[model samples]
Target chain A: LAKTTQPISMDSYEGQEVNITCSHNNIATNDYITWYQQFPSQGPRFIIQGYKTKVTNEVASLFIPADRKSSTLSLPRVSLSDTAVYYCLVGGSGNTPLVFGKGTRLSVIA
Target chain B: DAGVTQSPTHLIKTRGQHVTLRCSPISGHKSVSWYQQVLGQGPQFIFQYYEKEERGRGNFPDRFSARQFPNYSSELNVNALLLGDSALYLCASSLVGGDSNQPQHFGDGTRLSIL
Candidate 1:
């Protein structure tokens, strides 16, 4: 399993773009970066995932550099409902459960 | 389709007692994983089962045990519970192929309060 580092908290206004970066210097060859959004009292929801370069989905986008050591999750036009803790995970194997870090709490203020 | 479902949304127990947490995976999902989330912290993996076999285990002690049923439901059992054992128990389900890119679906979780 690869360890990940991320900001503890972030503040952003509505309609702004928020980017949260994660560092995984020891990322394995088979490791893939995944981001999840967790609201209060609910399970974390999958936002986006990427192996390298950029991958966009309906909810968010994930960008990974060639080194695979770091990645960022970009959320566009945020709203108050977007306030939640974001988790970055690095794992890829058969039935290997995801290991979560402290996660960055993003507060989308009005 | 319904997402992962956990039973007994909330439970209260005393120390030295045993507790059982149940999880029913989504339809067609063959893999189920368990996690423990303490307040103000991210969830920690406990176990993973696929095709009714144990596929992975976390660093938890032997007091934590889990098994998957034929229908892909899972149960997490903890014996001799301590005060520190109070937390939210989460269950996630995913489709397990040879690849590891499968996204997991999680449930609302079972909140266990130990006194």
Candidate 2:
């Protein structure tokens, strides 16, 4: 299992692109990077996942460097509704239990 | 198709009491995992069941136990609940249990309050 470090909180204006970076210096070769978003009273939802390079989805984009030690999650044109806690996780396999950090609390202001 | 569903959206329990939380995975999902999220913190894994078998267990105590049914639904049982047990219990289901590419879909979760 690999641990992740991210900012505790961030403030962004609506319509701006917000990029949150996570550091996993000890990431394993087989580990995959995944990002999840959680609202105030709901379970975390999967945002995007990637192994290397960049992967874009309808919700967000994940950028992983060649070293795979860190990744960034980018939310485009963030809106007030995009306010939530974003978590970055590294795991070897699906059956491997997910380990979550405090996460980055993103506050989108209009 | 419906997403993962948890029963009794909210629950209240007293200290030393037992509580059973139910989770119904997505239609074709065969793997169900349980997590506990406390206030101001992220979710902690409790257990994962695949094909009615236990696949993994977290650092939680013995008081936290879970089992999956034949239909892939699961029940998380907690014995001798304490005030610290008050948190949001989440259930996530994935298409397969061993594939990292398959993301887990989560439910809104059941809020358990221990008083």
Candidate 3:
């Protein structure tokens, strides 16, 4: 399992762009970077995933540098509802279960 | 289409008691995994089953066990529960293949509180 390190918490205001970075220095070659968002009393929701470079979707974008040691999740134009805990997971290949670290809690202000 | 479903939304058990949590995966999904989420921490993987076979096990103890049915449903049994066993037990289901690429759909989870 590849361990991930992220901020403990972050604060943002409405209409602002929020960028959360995760560091996985020992990430494996076959590992893919994935992000999940969990709201209060709910399961974690998939945000974005990428193997390398940049991957964009309707919700957010994942930017992975060439080294693949770190990745950033960019949420454009945040809102109050965007407040949640974001988790960065490194590996899920084959039969491997996802090991989640202490996620970064994003508190969106009105 | 219905997503993953877990039974006994909330449960309370004694320290020496045993408990069983059930999970029903989404239709057409063949992989089911269990996780334990303690307060103020991210969820930790406990077990993963594919096609009714035990595929992987996490760093949990022997007291924590799980099995998958032919229908792809699963049951997590914890024996001799303790206060530390109290947490949100989550179950996630996904299609078996490129596990990294396939996203797992999660249930609301069973909130277990041990006295």
lDDT of 1 by residue, B66-100 (tens): 99999999999999999999999999999877765
C-alpha DockQ for predicted model 2: 0.70
Predictions in order: chain A TM-score: 0.97, 0.97, 0.97
**DockQ for each model:** 0.67, 0.70, 0.62
Q: Residue-wise lDDT of candidate 1 within A14-92, one digit each (tens)?
A: 9999999999999999888889899988988888878999999999999999999999999999999999999999984
lDDT of 3 at B112: 97
C-alpha root-mean-square deviation, candidate 2:
1.2
Candidate 2's C-alpha lDDT?
A: 0.92
Q: State the lDDT of candidate 2 residue by residue for B72-93, as single tens digits.
A: 9999999999999999999999
Sort order, DockQ high to low: 2, 1, 3
Off by over 4 Å in 2: B97-100
lDDT: worst 10-residue window of model 2 chain A: A90-99
As a whole number from 0 to 100, the lDDT of residue B107 in candidate 3 is: 91
Report residue B56 deviation for candidate 2 (angstroms): 1.2
Candidate 3, residue A22: the lDDT equals: 98
Model 1, residue A77: C-alpha shift (Å): 0.7
Give per-candidate clash totals.
0, 0, 0
Better of 2 and 3 by TM-score: 2
